[model samples]
Target: MQHLDDSTRTELEAAAFRRLLHHLDEHKEVQNIELMILADFCRNCLSKWLVAAAEERGETLDYETAREYVYGMPYSEWKSLYQAEATPEQQAAFEARQAAKQEKGQ
Candidate 1:
């Protein structure tokens, strides 16, 4: 990538983040657990990282605000709209994965 001055690079990065968040919000059918089982990350993980990044920059932020930024709404609303019950197959796979992680001390 070509060099971007610090400010321009930062702005572009922030805009990209917002676009990603908007996409996530629009794709409400994509449950967080599905993201976790498939991608190893989810909305809650993103929110946690957002808070961590703010802290690293010496900005105080509460968890809920960070979560709202990531979810584009309240967590409960997102859950109602997007969350779904895991199928038996999903549950079995989750359990097997957990057992493997435990064996690895992850």
Candidate 2:
């Protein structure tokens, strides 16, 4: 990667991101709370990152549009179809993970 040209690196990164979105789309049962507990990020976080990235490039990306891209549909539609209420265990795990991050001054 150190030897790769900037354009090539960017292309590879973009491809990887697309693959990640596809993968997440395929795994809709893996809810956002599980992602937050395990990885500290989720689909909404990806949408926010995209919005921030577009802003950095002097572009305006609406959050809902980014979310639609990431979710493969309008978020409201996706939520109605697939999103689940967080189980008590999942909520506890997510809170513990946040506490750990706080302890590390993240």
Candidate topping TM-score? 2
Q: Each candidate: RMSD to true structure?
A: 2.1, 0.6
TM-score of 1: 0.82
Model 1 segments more than 4 A misplaced: 96-106
Tell me the tens digit of each residue's lDDT in model 2 across 1-106: 9899999999999999999999999999999999999999999999999999999999999999999999999999999999999999999999999999999999
Off by over 4 Å in 2: none
Question: Could you give candidate 1's per-residue lDDT for residues 54-78 as a string of tens digits?
Answer: 8999999889998988988888887
Note the Cα lDDT for every prediction shown.
0.85, 0.97
RMSD of 2: 0.6
Q: How many residue pairs clash in all the candidates, one count each?
A: 0, 0
Judged by lDDT, which candidate is best? 2
Candidate 2, lDDT over the whole model:
0.97
